[model samples]
Structures are given as structure tokens and as C-alpha cells.
Target: MTSEETEEVVETTTDSSTGAARITAAPYMPGKTFTNMFEKYATDGLPDVFDISFFGNISGSTIAQIRSTMRYFDLIDDQYVPTDLMKELVGTDEETRKGLLKMMVEEKYPDALGLSQNATSGQLAKVFNERGLTGATVDKAISFYLHMLDYLSIPYSSHFKKRRPSSNGGARRRAAKKAAEPTPPPVHTPVKPKVSTEEEQKAAYVQTLLDLAKKDGADADLQDRIFDRIEKALGIGGGPAAPTTTGGGTTDSP
Candidate 1:
């Protein structure tokens, strides 16, 4: 067939199982069109133990093959694999690898086959009918589930190894809150100077008066006289006597 005829035939056979509305041919490539390979190989029933065991082994092999294929496709850069599940599988003993994959498939991807631990085949079959969990998308679903398990393991094992994150954001927030709050000012005791006793005060007063008298200035003498007058008026002696008057209007001169 001519290239045009081949293109037309390819276009006619294209299928749309995913969300896209139409299937299109690969640009500039004849007989090389997109296909839902996942849907093509996907199954709704839980796989039996034999198939489970086989696929577990198959996945590891496929992972290696995919890596090799990706290299061929020039897709390898930096690191081809993020998580080491594939690498672990490659290094692990076949029996252990099989058991691990089986456990994962049984626990997580049970609906893909009719052999899950929790749900019966009939129940899963009904779910597949209602939700249309076709075989084509099973690989993606499985990959997604395994990726989630790996994510969970990363944090879990890090904690188990005591590699906790250094910065606790919650603790930081609490500290910041404490810092933001207003603090009460410190209470301080007032210092009191030593006070003189009454006797000490009287001695000081007498000294001040004597000092004023000895000072040669007129202002100093005036201050001394004022203080002396105050002392006499307070009945300390030398003030004129106050005269007494009788209520009968007669005064006796003494």
C-alpha cells in the first residue's frame, strides 16, 4: 500500500479507551501509532498465586528491560530510576523478591486479578463492572500504588533510623508566638538612703547654727538671729513673757 493508504488504514484502526476523545496517528511515522498497551494487557480479576508469583518476577525483569530500553531510547539522564524497588528486586533472591511483590500485589492491587486477600473474586468483578477497572490501566494503577508505598517507606525508615528532620515547623511557630507576646517589665526594689536619728538631727542643727554665727558675712549673722528668734518663740528660752489679763478687767503689774 502507498504511504497515504497505510496512514489511512492506521487512522481507521486507532482506539480511544482513555479520556481523550480521538486517537491520532504518530506524526511523520507510518504504521507507528499510539496504542493503549496497558489496557491491552490489563485484567480486572485478581490473579492466582501462580500468576501473582510470575508477574512479580516479570515486573522485576520488565523493570530491567524498561531501563535497558530507555537507554536505547536515549532517555537515561542523571538517574533513570528514582526509587530503588527495581534495583532491590534485581539484587534480591528470587524467592524473597517474589514474596515481596506478591504481598504488595495482594495488599494493594488485588482487584487486578480475582485473588486479593480481602475481597472475593465475585465482589471485585462487580466493582470492575461498575467502575470499569480494565486491564489496560492496571499497570499505571499498580505503579501509582507502589510509588505511594515507597513514599510512605521513605519517611517511615528515616524516622526509624533516627534521621528526623532538623527543623520542626510547629516548634518554630510556637517559639515565634512566644516571642511575639508582650512580657511584663521587671520589678525593682527602691533603694533608701540611711536616715539620721532625732539626736543626730539635733546635733547637726546646733552645728549648723554655730557655723552660721562664725561666718563673718551680714547675711550669715541675720540667718543666725532668725534661727535664735525661732528657738525662743518655740519656748526654748529667752523670749519676752506673754502678759496675762484677768477676765474682771483688772490687770496686776508684777
Candidate 2:
């Protein structure tokens, strides 16, 4: 062990019951996985080696977990040969199965179980940690243990019974959903409003005057003034010059 790992080990406290655990690591796989393996194998009879040939289509890692779980419960010997306990634990008689299951818990996890008939998940985890389990292994181990407890009708406080998770579910769901969605449309930039220039305003004013002058009610005098205004506005050499005299003599034009 590295000095750091030794230090971590030194930090852990061991209960007498914890020290009694036969296996080094907890079965981090689902308890049901291996329990089912045991029951089905009991139906088919024991294998010569609990290897790929026996387990069939599952991954190597999963086979290792099954082997580890079997070791934890003392269900198999060093050669991975099924012990009599393995067969009896999966037998048809409920009473025999329950007895063996209880005995297995007392042997493997008396530390946490002895703490309380109803210890919370946190309490159980602390016991596992003290037994040198760490990282993601800790939670997974706790899950398997909890499943065993439930299977034997053992009640615990402070944990809602958790369903076994679908493998890598959240990430798989997010990836699938992302692939299925269509790409978003490109953002639309709004067109800026066109501002009228001062020259444009002036031209518009001149045009309005011209249009009014063309109206029927406009007398020639009014039309002339309007045209003068238009000429001045357009800078057509017309300025605010003196008013011209009209046929009306002294013109009323100011």
C-alpha cells in the first residue's frame, strides 16, 4: 500500500463485527443480479467454474461482481465452486432460504445490522467506509446490502427503499434526447428604422404646399405665395424678398 493509502486505512475504525467480514470488498453490483444468478444456477445445477461459460452474455466486469458477491456471502469457495450454502440459500423452502439469508447477514454485515435493526443508510455507509470501502464503490455496496436486507424482510430506518437504477440512465437519456432534437433556426436581427434627413423633410413640406395650391379653392394670389414658398425652400434663387404688387393694387400679401 502507498503511504497515503496506509494513512487512509489508519484513519478507519473497525468494529469487532466489521473485523469479522470474510471478504475484502462489498459486492457493488445489485444484490438481485447475483441472487438471481444463484437461484437460476441452482435450477440448472452447479457449474464446474463460475466463468463466462456458466454466466453467458454478460460483460466480464459483471461476472467479476457475481464472483465477488458470492465470496462476500461465503456462497462459494476459493475455486469459485458453489458451496452447499449457495444451493440451500436458493432452495424451494422459504423457511430454509430465510434462515440462510439471516445467517449470511449476521456473518458478513453484523457491523451495520448490529448497530440497529433499523439503522439509516448513513449509518450503514459509515460502517462500510470504516471497513475500507471508498469512492463510488461505497454507494454501490450500500445498494446491494440494502437489497439483501429487503429480501430477507429486514426493516431499516432513514432510507426510502430505492429501486435498482437502470445502468447509466441519466447520461444515456440526455444523449438520446439531444440526438433526436432538430437544430435551432439562426437568430433573426431586426432591421433598423430609416430616419428622414432634414432635406427630405423640407422637400416633403414643399410638395405639400404644391399639392394644396393645385386644390380648386386656391385663388391665383394664394397659389403664387405657395409657389414662392416652394421656390425659397428649394433654394431656387428665391429668398424673403419684398412682396410683389398684385392686380388688387396695394397687395394684401405681407
Candidate 3:
């Protein structure tokens, strides 16, 4: 959890859970912005020194998603250098690209590839659910698979084809219920002085959310529903009433 009044920043992936240090797993998240970078790499050329500078003005979170997607697809080496797979993706013919993607789907996401074209979103989720995924965590993996299939012109369950609007249906109901039930007065929270670097603080905030999302995924949703809970809990107001879900946030992609 991030403190609105806090001034100190804790560096690195320290475990605040149960006092034991946690070993990490290979990163494999994909987010909405990942495709943008993957596409940009094909056009802009992945610089030899791959780092923040490689993606221009995008946020650090965006870069993290992009890197995670690359790693997930085995497109980049541990050092962030483009692998032969990625180079081939960038330069291959359309048919070869399809073959390469199919190979990846078979090897890395056999569960996703096995799904029937008419499967429902709930069924799609069940595939990940059985693997212990939940929330934006599941969204990341699914987003990557979906985008890859889209790029390959592969058929998938039409259930997952719809975007974020109708899903906001739940959001609207929650917003209304919250509006009708609110009565407590706001508790005035004391302000604390800033003592951390702006960028570092931003990174810390994002890392906290990412860490939380990851833990559950290891059972996830990203924006809208997930963020709505975060916003209400934080009492950060978008307006007098909750705002309707709008726009896309992040999704897993490569």
C-alpha cells in the first residue's frame, strides 16, 4: 500500500510478507502498451543498448510491461537484448511470422492454443484460473495470447473479443450503489512532507500495485474494476460520484 502522506521510499523487492525472503520467477507479464513497443521495435529498430531510452517518452511501468512481454515470448535475452526469435519476428515474411507465433503458442501457452474458438470468456478465464491466475495478472497473460492470435489471424472464442465498455456495466452498478449508500464524513488525513525523488516514488507506487497483482496471479484484472477498488479505498476522488469506466489501461501483449 502507498501512503499519501509518506516521505520515505524503500528500494528493491523487499518482502513485507511473513518476514521471509522470496525467490523470484522469470518475468512474463504482457500489458496493453507492450504491443506498442513491440511494433515500435519492428519499425524504430531496437537499439543495441536496450533500456529506458529505447522506448522514448513512455513511463517506466510501460517499459516494464514491454520487457515482461518480450521475456514471456522468449523474444529477448535476460539482458534485454533482442533474441534471434525477436529479430526473426521483426524481419520475417508473413507466413514465417505465423509459423513462429504458432510455435510459441504451442510451447509457451498450450492452454491458450487448446481453447475452442467458441469458448466463452468465463471458459477462457477458467483455463487461467485452473493455473492459479486472477485479476490483471491473468489479464496480462491473456492479453499477450490474444494479441498474438490477432496478429496471426487465428480464430479464438468470440467471448473474449469484446473490449472494455460493456464490462463497465458492473462498474456502473457499483458506482450507483456506492452513491446511494455513502454517508460518512471524510476524515482529514494529515499531510506529510515530500522526501523522496519524484520518479523513485512513482516507481515505488507502481511496484507496490504490481507486486500485489503478481502475488494473486502466481492466481487478476487491471484497470477499471481493479483500479476502482484502489481509488475508493484511497478516497481519491475523480468527482462527486464515481466516474464511469472509460478508456483502456494496460493489457498483456507482445
Specify the highest-TM-score model's number.
2
- Kindly list the per-residue Cα lDDT of model 1 for residues 1-254, writing each as its tens digit: 32211111112122346543221211111111111121222333222221223335445434443333223222232244323444344345645655655564344333334434454334433433433333423223233333433533421122222212235366789999999999999999898966655444445445555566567774855876746744643458667422233455213221
Q: After superposition, how far is residue 162 of candidate 1 from its true place, in Å?
A: 51
Off by over 4 Å in 2: 1-24, 117-120, 160-254
10 residues in a row with least lDDT, candidate 2 = 3-12
Residue-by-residue lDDT tens digits, candidate 2, 164-249:
33354667889999999999999999999776565556665666777889999999999988888777767785685333333453
Which stretches of model 1 miss by more than 4 angstroms? 1-82, 110-122, 134-254
Model 3: per-residue Cα lDDT over 182-236, one tens digit each: 6999899999976655444434444555566556443324534545444543457
Better of 1 and 2 by TM-score: 2
After superposition, the stretches of candidate 3 with alpha carbons farther than 4 Å from their true spots are 1-39, 162-254
Report clashes for each candidate as comma-separated counts.
Answer: 10, 0, 14
